[model samples]
Target: MSKQVMLAASAVAVLMSCTVNAATEIQWWHAMGGSLGDKVNEIAEGYNATQDQFVVKPVFKGSYPETMTGAIAAFRAKQQPHIVQVYEVGTATMMSADKAIYPVHQLMNDSKEKFDPTAFLPSVTGYYTANSGEMLSMPFNSSTPVLYYNKSMFEKAGLSDADAPKTWNDLELVATKLLASGAQCGFTTGYQSWVQLENFAARHNVAFASNDNGFGGLDTELLVNNKAFVDHISKLEQWSKTGAFKYGGRASDAASLFYSGECAMYMNSSASYAGIKENMPNTEFGVSELPYWPSVIEQPQNSIIGGASLWVLQGHPKQDYEGVAEFFSYLSSAKVQADWHQFTGYLPITQDAFELTESQNFYQENPGTRIAIEQMTAVTPTKNSKGLRLGNFVQIRDVVDEELEQVWSGKQSAQQALDAVTARSNELLKNFERVNSKS
Candidate 1:
């Protein structure tokens, strides 16, 4: 070969190698598992395919609490991922990690990404926004609790699918009918603290904590031990005694009870739709708005969200952040967000995404898919109905679960259990406040 031809070939090889080495890998740690984990992988793959500058690597880091704990430890060791998915309850904790996080709003601004905070749903973004009106994290997989019922079980119980419970009183009646019809368990729930307590309070337009559910300041305290909460818990305890209501353990563990046809009705995150559908493909189920208490309010208030958000962590290079911003922009596109919302039952964080899904007739094709959106946007959110932003909320949820379990097991009365929960959770809040107050 001629020397000039050889030199051209060698230069071509060098350029190819430089291009391959220039692709930055962005580590993304998350808690989504099962079918949801697969979706996360697909999203990362789609973005990587669109560009060669940055490759996103998604790693499942166990459950929400576990993922958050892992990220905190990693940050302390200066080995944190570029992005970590944190549950809503951990928002306060993430916010307090001032040196460890790069606020989404700030990151977008610094990276010069065209972002409009107003593009997101107010009800969804309210949970992750700062007092200064900046978005702290990218809202992903936002979901409100909804009622899921076994259609066949309802028919066997002589209940019409159209008559799905609308109020707490109605729920009790339905549970009784299901139990009387020889159903193994009439109703069950997952994320007891989230669906039952936090959302319960929000739906009733009652306070979950003082200082506007911890959104106003860090000096907030729990107020879930009110008369309404006590009454609701007491009713559930009574149902537990009659076998009308079964305690399904914690998290989404009880989802098995509903999908397996053991329970006639289940109350869990709207995002559980994907898992429920995948697990029970042969069974027909119906989704409805979460029941509310008529005695507490003339009409039910809006429900709050319960899924995790994508938080950008600090310690990444400037170029890495540019890639992160671009990836985020792609993730927020109407097509991408709409596809995700339809597939996973998560709320389309952006209004355009929701509109895109609607325009596609996805909700009409899939019955009950829009129940969560309707529930969340039923009414203008009041301070009480917006969402919680308490410190140490994750640990507080554990306290709530523990105390509520006492009530479920007949070890403590509803009032006593709630009182204990309030006291213990307040201590956690105080500690979080002491540590993060100056930040």
Candidate 2:
């Protein structure tokens, strides 16, 4: 070989090195902790390994509220990450920051990546889309509440593992048996306001707000104190007295109780699968859809998404935006999405990923992983059931928790507590509407 060839070879090696090592670094903020956090790292690692041009650095900032606060602080300080993992309740808050986000559809289009609004689960995508069907955020760990039962506890109480309660009536009957058989608490729940009221309203085919549950407009009202909500809370209050149900603290505090086997059944996010599997492997656990109020409209309706999505924060350099698009495209790949769903029990955001999982029999073998998907697909989600998009929803959830706590503690009747919540919540909603309109 000639000396020229040797020099050319050296030059090529240097060029390749420059491209790979010069990979754009994109920062991401999330709220996941414990085993769920591990699953997130695995996917980011995979994406980083398969690419030479981009790196996604996921940062665990804290719980959902804390993470949202951190993101806002970063943005205010002009140090915001390119992507932020915001919980579903923070949707309106994120949207209210008009210049702070890059609406995922726009970002994908600008970067020339293939994107389709119709291809995602309506129950997941609908919450993040604009009026024109353009998605504002990339659907990430979307989840719905499901009943997690300790199969060992259930069977010990003479309950069938295959038969999960479908209605509140069935839940009460089984819960009574579990308690009678010596279970400390027959049932408990995490995110009480989340599963019991927000998603509960959806499953009952009841409107959580006017204007298609806040999708059609910013002027939405609170309806959690409606007949459906009253009846459900009344029952829970009654059960609380017998110690058949344990009232966990705010923001999914019941996770500890359920994972510790303190309760026979827990209604929590289907996303909790990884944690249950990790900490309670020796315990026989079962996952099923959250029970609906049979007193409400009969039959089942769709459950809305609970987990956060990747919102592209705007106000960045053109190069940064380009890098953001590339990284997002990487996340949207069938391989990454499939593995993410398999690892985390999150609903597959893309149709291709869902099909891939089914073809591979990922769900057939995994008992509880399919429960979230089944709940999501049970109905062709209507506008009313698609999900909430109201402004200041984060604050509203707090109000729900506060009022419901009163009921749970026997300080107030369910009707009184719920009615008070409704009146107070509407004021907050109106305030949000007023401010958002001006903005």
Worst 10 residues of 2 by lDDT: 113-122
Backbone clashes, each candidate? 0, 0
Candidate 2 residue-wise lDDT, 291-318, digit = tens: 8866677788988888889898876777
Query: Model 2 clash pairs?
Result: none
Candidate 2 vs. true structure, TM-score? 0.90
Per-residue lDDT of 140-214 in model 1, one digit per residue for the tens? 889999999998888988989777999888888898888888898989999999899999989989999999999
Model 1's C-alpha root-mean-square deviation from the true structure amounts to 5.4
TM-score of each: 0.92, 0.90
Candidate 2, 130: how far from true, in Å? 2.0
Find the number of clashing residue pairs for candidate 2: 0
